[model samples]
Target: MKRLVALLFALALAGATQAQDGPAAEAEAAARMLEEATRALDDASAARDRVKALTQTVRAYEAGLQAMREGLRRAAVRQQALERDLAAREEEIAQLLGVLQSMSHTPAPVTMLHPTGPVGAARSGMILADVTPGLNARVVKLRAKLDDLVVLRALQDSAANRLEDGLRGAQAARAALSQAIADRTDLPRRFTEDPVKTALLIASTESLDGFASGLSQIAADPTGAPGPAAELAKGSLPLPVQGRLLRGAGEADAAGIKRPGILVAAPPRALVTAPAAATLRYRGPLLDYGDVAILEPRSGLLIVLAGMETTFGETGEVLPAGSPVGLMGGLEPDDDGIVPARLQDPGSDWTQTLYIEVRQDNTPVDPAQWFRTDKDD
Candidate 1:
């Protein structure tokens, strides 16, 4: 029985250690990612391609923040499971303790003896042999649960500091990237924008279709040549931002209003980029669609991204594939590093939605047919 107990105890310890390591390892890896992002930010200042470097820094921070959130979520779930297990096993734990205590205090000779006779003693011994193993198994599970609770609780406490650092780093990287984009003047210009014509076009149009049909009116004339055609990129272009599909094309919202575009639910302050080399046909507020970016990748192919808080690049500039376009808006984190309310609540925090539409020859097409949406972001 002692040997069995010892073996069970060892197994329980191992199990508890493994359980504790899972979330702890995830948190550590996330911290490393945040650290790498910080390094990237430092490197951006001296990089020949400041926009690219800052972009990488911003993306790194996003990845780290995501990982950290996932780690905390896992830890919280594990803690809850441990708490439930402990609560459910309260009676079993008490019984196990009582039995072990009673066995410990009883003299060995007394435990072996039976009140009736040698036969009764033999039977009692056999019964004890059968029950002892089960009791030890229960004891092992209880010990493991207790250990896991302690480790997970401690992990949560330590994680707060790491999470705060990562949040601050992410904010700094975003600000730097925004500045880098604004200061950029190296991108080629496809055409010069006629602001008066663009304004007239917006004032005369009430829908995206109407506005798209009149896009050419805003451009003075073609100057720089267009980039390589995006025909081969069909059905394989990455989404402009890292997010999940909130609504498919032509899906109606709660208000029963339907648009021929897809809505992508992204985290707050997420970066939006150009999925292909394209000209910045027009960017800014239009009607009730919020800030918009219209990209012309080919003569008749137009990609429109709307609902961002900010947009980058002047109209008619040729943007390379994966260039920063804008950022999704959200409430800022509180002072002292408390996570933003949006981030604290993951279920509803995808408050920022990027509206994406692909138009061919002045008609809206299903964005999914152009952008790949099968993989997790």
Candidate 2:
């Protein structure tokens, strides 16, 4: 009987020992598996064909790791509960052994031991069965689950880091491509030839009021010419203004339209003199005409002063040739208060300008043909 009891105790001790070691073994195995998965991900990142596949694998690994982490938490909880239960059971067993020892010490008559019948034997057998095996099995299972969770967490972290790096690389590549394209393509310049004529016309109409009056007279003309009817009939018109021709008369395009005029660059605020002695036909600002002046100088020519802001003579006022009409003002500054006012060129010192237009009848004619350097002739 003593030998049988000792054997049963030995079996329970062995079972307990197995249960304690199972979790550690399982944890080690899971760690090895996680390391293998990490290596596979690194290999995928290096391979071109397998890069996409690697990304997917990394995501999967990450998910698995998260699930493993949760599992580890649960396993830890279970392990704690199991440990508490085992401790309580151990305490109870210790108390029972103490009671048994105390009972043994009590003075009692020793009775003759007799073997029970089959039913009694079976009941005794059931009572002696060890529960250590079941406890060991549960502990081993929990340990294995915890190990798997640890492995999964490691994999997930690695995958997340790789994904971040990949995204940054992709963004950088795209930016480089865009910059390359921009470098290859040449952008258009802001200033173009289309605005040349428009600028010239604007320069022609520097004075607003004079331009207006000139257009009104042309509109009221019976011969439909830009000058007085009497002057037009005689095949002569008034000189617009008196200024040295800086640019010769020619055809130029402005704002996508052809304009015929002579660019007569003059001194800033210089007095505009009439080309001939004639009546003041118009003296006001016109559309595209700044301060302008039109005079019927003789039967053959019409002079136009396009930059005059103020005029001395009214319509029908008689004036002799080379008379002072208006003063020239500089171009107004832009809204930003920045003015690009400078001399036309290094050779020409004149910054302010007045445009002079000469016309035959209603059509513009070359001023070079009729304009003389001196009025002495």
RMSD of 1: 3.3
lDDT of 1 by residue, 167-241 (tens): 788788888888888898888787788778888898899898889879855553645666646654668899999
lDDT string, candidate 2, 1-377, tens digits = 33333333343333222222333344344444444445555565355434233333333343333233333333344455666765667776566445544544554322122167667666655654564355345435544444444433443344344434433332332233233323322322112223344345445664433343234333223333233234222323233332354555564536553335556554333335555565565666656556767666544455676766555444544554444455555431111111112211222323455666666555677665665533311
Instruction: Identify the runs in model 2 with alpha carbons over 4 angstroms from their true place.
Output: 1-244, 253-258, 299-301, 331-348, 373-377
Overall lDDT per candidate, in order of appearance: 0.80, 0.44
Best-fitting candidate, measured by TM-score?
1
Kindly report which residue stretches of model 1 are placed more than 4 angstroms away from their true locations once superposed: 1-22, 107-123, 228-231, 332-346
lDDT assessment of candidate 2: 0.44
Q: Which residue pairs in candidate 1 have backbone atoms (N, alpha carbon, C) closer than 3 angstroms, thus clashing?
A: none
Which candidate leads in lDDT? 1
